[model samples]
Target chain A: MRDRLRNVLAGVLEVRPEEICADMSAEDVAGWDSLRQLEVMLALELEYGVRIPADAMLELQSVPAIEEFLTEHGAG
Target chain B: MSRLPTAEEIAGRRRQGLELTRVERPEATALHVLATFNLDLLPPFLTEAFDRVGRSVRPRAGAFGQLTQEILDPASRLYAEPPDEVLIVPAAEDLLEPLFSRPPSQLGPDEAEALVEERLAELRGLVETVLERLPAASCYVVALGATEGPHPHVLDPLAPERRQVELDRFMRGVRELRSLGPRTVVIDWDWHMRSFGWDAVRDERLWYLGRMRLNPTGCAALAELVARHAAAYRGQARKVLALDLDGTVWGGIVGEAGLGGIEVGEDGVGLAFQDFQRELVKLQETGVLLVVCSKNNPADALEVFERHAGMVLRREHLAAERINWQDKATNLRDLAVELNLGLDSFVFLDDNPIERTWISQACPEVLVPELPDDAAERPAFLRAASWFERIEATAADRGRSASYREQRERRQFERTSTSFEDFLSSLEQEAIIDPVHEGSLSRAAQLCQRTNQFNLTTRRHTVAELESMSSDPDHDLFTLTVRDRFGDNGITGIAILRYAGELAEIETLLMSCRILGRKLEDAFLAFLARRAADRGASVLEGTFVRTAKNAQVETFYPDHGFERAEDGVYRLTLTQGAVESPASIMVTVPANA
Candidate 1:
């Protein structure tokens, strides 16, 4: 599950999965801007078959937050 | 037509497209995008869509909600360094904020009507400004969609007071802007939304997060539409739709099942085939020449068009037919020759995977779309294919199939004649040469793009470029219209000549392949040489740039009393009088020319 989440994040951010650390957020990545953050949320919904609420879309900017949210929604 | 790409796939393509744009490809087309909302997510998808069609594009979006500023200001990024193409997307929610922010019940009928009119006028002004500022760019304006506004009653008829009705009025007004100019094309965003489903296209999460109205799926769909339009603008639109007979057009094999046993009536799967045939007929009406390339007995196939009660397509509907036992690729090539079109303009449809694969390998230029597995999905599949899209159909386009039938009659006349010169004289061909006018601009530009075999320098100039060239003093643009004993072939030839102090250079000279062997090219060139000499020129020069398809005309200049000079250039001195036109053709020139 961790590997899959990293792959999804890396795909949207246009980075290597090996470079995607759990602590990395939008600011830490080179191409991860606010527009890419929306793409990240949308990709998570499609990859995990889970719906992240609108308010939580902005909060899940870091890789760790996305994994935690996915686990809480039973997608893990 | 297969399946909409998933979010993960779209993400991967977007990344790939971004990486592709970072490289310096000199052949890439530049595209500028302007929208009413945050359209930052569109460039990558648009780049991928254009890439899928074998075209690379560099897309840059303007600041959000700056459509008006970009159009009005001459120093804006859109006008500073103009792009090859422009895409303008306007949403009803952003354009009509006052009406949407309030309830439909609160707004009066007169107030809503006035507001809608004012907004549409503003949009028209912006589009006109863009068209004037970027005369050489192909602009695509997306019509307003009913993405916002309160839901009305299920069975309520549209009224001016209703917000939904007002939005519909706005969309229709936008569609009429297609008449503003030849280069302006209005995309029906409402139709795309209804076809793709409203729920699947819009994402509330993205809207709240970054004010983006469309999700990745919607973005991909829009990108596909714009890319198809761009390809059509570049003259990549297909002209011929070639189909196979048996299990492809109808159900079952005609050789084994016979006419009575074939499934093509108004019942179950049979109805599907009938509907599919109807779609093909629609395509035929739109000037796409339909031809049969089936591997069956000619008599057997002819009987289906003559006697089948369920057949929607008749023998007259087909511009040409190749019902032989030959290979599919060979049949398509023969059809291209018979129709006087390049193989790149042919789109082949066949249900058999083996035949499709064969044609794909043999003739790489032919577009062979994969038909759906289910028979019922065939009609929808044809509707979704964008290879036959055109921005606007000219008069010549609408009369193409009928003109091809006339060409068939001319071929029969040629067979019975004793000699080539005798055939040319008996045809009584009359060539009318004139400067490019308003009515003939589209067809002239089309000939410049689509004419490959007989063209000397294959330069594909757009209508806007041709218009500007026609107004220039030192350049002369001429179109040749041919009328033989059989029929009027419309404007089938074009020539562009550049004049200097003492030299007249033939910049472009091309004729439609239908009029190739008729000595029309000789008459056209003779007329141009005389015109150049009359304009106080001492020498006439032409260059023959070799292409794969134009090898037959490598020595055309030399055959017409021209001496070969250095660098593949042919020179003829006007002091000795221009080369005389063939006596077989009666040529007429405009008084001004």
Candidate 2:
């Protein structure tokens, strides 16, 4: 699940999947702006068939938060 | 056509498109996109859409919520580097906020009408500004559709308070912009939303998260719609639809089922075929030529058209047919030869997978679409297909099938004549040559783009470019219309001449294949030479730039008393007098010329 979330984030951020760590947040990444954050939320929703709520979109900026949210939504 | 890509695939394609743009490619079409809402998700889907039609577009997104500013301001990025095409997408909620934010009951009828009028006028101004600034760009504007709020009088059929009435009025007003100029194409956003369903087009989560109105799925669909229009604008739209009979059109094989036993009537699956044929007839009316390319006995197929009770397509509706046991690929090639059209302009519809595969391999230029497995789905499939999409259908387009039928009769007339000179005189051809006017601008531009075989220099000029040239004092644009005893072939030729001191150069000279062998080219050249001599030019020049298909016209200039001075340039001295028109045809030139 962590690797899958890392891959989705890497695709959206246009970085290497190996370089994406679970502890990395939007602030830590160089290219993860607000627009890239929205892309990350969309990619995660499409990949897991899960609708990340509008309010939770901004909160799931880190790879760990996205993994936890996906698991809670039964996508893990 | 394949199914619409999923959101994941769209994202991946967007990345691929971005990577492709990093490496420079020559002759790539520049496309500038401006919208009212966030269009960050559109570039990737748009890239894939243009790529599907074998065109590479470099799309640059304008600032969000700056649709009007980008067009109104001259120094905007849109004008910094002019684009070959412009796509302007304005949302109803953003453009018409007063109508949506306030309930209909709060405003009077006059007030509502006045508000809608004001917004439409502003939109027209913006579109006209774009058309004026970019004389070579083709502008595509999306009409306003339904707003996102609820309606109090939604259930009422004739309620004035219903927002749909106002939206409908706005859409109609937007459609009128097509007449503003030939290059402006107004896309039916309302029809697209209704066809795609409102839920798929609008995402509430995205609306709140960002200002984005459309989700990834909706973005992909809209991109495809724009791409289809782009294809039509580039003169790449399909012209002929080759159909198969038997299990493809009707329920069973006519050879075995007999006319009476066939399942094409007013009930069950038979009605499905009937409905599908009705849709095809609509397509025919829009100027797409319908031809039969079936592998059956000629008698059995002709009998179906003669005696079938439920047949919607009659014998006269078909422009041509190849009802034989020959292979479809060979039959298509024969049809291309008969119709004087390229094989790339054909769309083959057949139910047999083997035949489709065979044609796809043998004649790769022909577009063979996959029909649905179920017969009931075929009508909807035809409606959804965008192979014959046109921005506006001209009068000549509506009467194309009839003209082709007349062409067949003319061929028969030619075979019976004693000699070539006798045939030319017996046909009684009349040619009317005139300067390009407002009424004939679209067809004139169309001739410039679609004519290939007889073109001297193949320059595909846009309507906007031609419109500007017609008003310039240095250029003369002429269009020719030919009429014979058979029928009137409308606006079949175009020629553009640019003057400089003592020299007048033929920038573009092309005639439709319908009137190629008729010696009308000589008469048309004569008219041009006279016009150039009257304008005080001493030398009339023409060039033959070689294309794969235009080789037949290689020696055309030298045959008509032009001396070859350079590799492709030919010069004819006006002091030697213009070439004479053939006595068999009566030619009429403009009085002013």
For this target, which candidate reaches the highest DockQ against the unseen true structure?
1
Q: Write the per-residue lDDT of candidate 2 for residues B105-159, one digit (tens) a residue.
A: 7875678778888998999999999988998898998874764434654677446
DockQ of the candidate models in sequence = 0.78, 0.62
Instruction: After the best TM-score superposition of candidate 2, give how far the Cα of residue B104 lies from its true spot, in angstroms.
Output: 4.8
The 10-residue segment of model 1 chain B with minimum total lDDT is: B153-162
Off by over 4 Å in 1: B1-3, B102-107, B150-155, B159-161, B575-577
**Clashing residue pairs found in predicted model 1:** none
Q: List the residue pairs that clash in candidate 2.
A: none
B1-593 in candidate 1: lDDT tens per residue? 23467766776778778888778888987899999998888999898899987799899999889999988989999987889788999988888887877765677766887898999999999988887787777789988486656545434656433576788788888898888766788887777656556677678878877888887888887888788877776666789999999988889998898999898989999999999999998888878999999999898889988999999888888999999999888889898888878899999999999999999999998998999879999988888888887777877888788889999999899999999999999999999999997778778878887888999988888887887788789999999999989989889999998999899999999998888888899999999899899888889999998888898789999999889987768999986446878999999999998
